[model samples]
Target: MIRFHLKCDQDHAFESWFQSGEAYDKLAASGMVSCAMCGSTKISKSMMAPAVSTSTSVTPPKPSAAMLAELRKRVESASEYVGSKFVREARDMHDGLVPERPIYGEAKPHEAKKLLEDGIPVLPLPFMPSKKTN
Candidate 1:
């Protein structure tokens, strides 16, 4: 599977997975590929950086410290930290004991699967701060 960064005429950006480049073209031509945010069909692939190169002089760009701090702040503000009690907290919220709120926590894969099976919305965050052990 290949992931493509796509943009719609409405300036909405999103990623889509396609089986192959040919498959992406086929779907786009058939009007099957639509923007998730705006539901616009006037979508096109955005320019992507080359995946591989023989040149060793090119250096990968790094995220600025300010950008990293901003990302951390966004995550911190957007979700409540439940630590190791993620599963229990999630279950509590699902049962309506606590008011619904965005939360983030660590859970085993099995726990996450069970939560999903129970129809609770959950997504794995790409980055999570390590729990300090003192």
Candidate 2:
């Protein structure tokens, strides 16, 4: 996995992972690379230092557990939990078969990829706890 920081024509900055430098190049050339904020295809790689090790003791900052928990809470509270129906619900909404609203749910990796390929906007939320069943 290789991550690259990118900027769109509107100056929206975001990061995305590609399979390789060749993959990124191919995508960019084909206009597949786009901005996360504005969905602009006019993207360019931004300056970022290589993640090579300069010292053995260097460490990255870790996010607090409380912060992750808070983020998870906010996401759950703001979105409807569709559970396993996530892919279907998202597709329905995108195709105008259902009303569009904030939603969150489980999808297989391939499902998410298919959604993107179909131009249905979907984002994966990080640090999501298991869905509570009652």
Candidate 3:
């Protein structure tokens, strides 16, 4: 499947997915494509740059461990560590039961999924090392 950004004569911009470029051309030629916003049939491909892929598929450079550690330290200082009560605190904040503030902690995979399903914003902290227990 291919997606194309389309614009109508009314200058209404929208996107539509097509099976192929030929399919898009056929649809546009037949005036089947219409603007989603203004309902105009005069649709054309909008200006967009093509994504260029490297032939050798060069891997992007990753941040050093020290950089990640420093970032983690900064986040820990800025956000409250709720530990095991992450889900409860997150739910409370989502429901307006608790004052909203920056928080970070541990949560089970299913618990995080449930929160996301419930329309709550939850982001996984990447490159955060586990705390060492005494």
Candidate 4:
């Protein structure tokens, strides 16, 4: 995989990974590449520094367990726990059948995929909803 720094006609910059240089060429030539900001298809590769390895390559610090537990608490406090009716409640809210509100709950993988495919914006919480905790 190769990561390329790209710029659009509007000067919007973004990076993307491709299987290979040939793959990137094929996609770009076919107008598949587009500006991440404005959706313009006029994309071009920008100059990028070569990848290098050094002992000083920084690794991002991991968040502490306390931080995660605090996050879980804050999220639970801010959202309603919908238990397993998550999918129905979320879909209902999306379709305007119910007032839109923050909710968290358990959902099967397939159900989550269906919601995303339908463009109903759902995100996975790092921890299970508190209602389901033992």
Most accurate candidate by TM-score: 2
TM-scores, all models, native as reference: 0.49, 0.54, 0.51, 0.53
lDDT of 1 by residue, 1-134 (tens): 57788999999877766656765786577565666555677999998875665757887456567655555565565567888888998899879888767667788999987887776656565567444221
**Candidate 3 on 29-104: residue-level lDDT in tens?**
7555666455577888988777677688877456567756666776565568888888999899879999877677
Where does candidate 3 have its weakest 10-residue lDDT segment?
125-134
Ranking according to TM-score, highest score first: 2, 4, 3, 1
**Window of ten residues with lowest summed lDDT in model 2:** 125-134
| TM-score winner, 2 or 3 | 2
Model 2 lDDT tens row, 1-134? 57898999999887777756766786687565666455577999999988786667876456568755765766675568888899999899878899877778888999988887776656667665457541
The local lDDT score (0 to 100) that residue 88 gets in candidate 4 is 98
Q: Candidate 1, clashing residue pairs?
A: none
Which residue pairs of candidate 3 clash?
Answer: none
Question: Which scores higher on TM-score, 3 or 4?
Answer: 4
For candidate 4, write residues 34-128 as lDDT tens digits: 55456677899999999888889787456567756766766676578888899999899879999877678989999987887776666566676
Error of 3 at 53 (Å): 9.9
Model 2 has an lDDT value of: 0.75
Worst 10 residues of 1 by lDDT: 125-134
* Clashing residue pairs found in predicted model 4: none
Candidate 3 positional error at 24, Å: 32
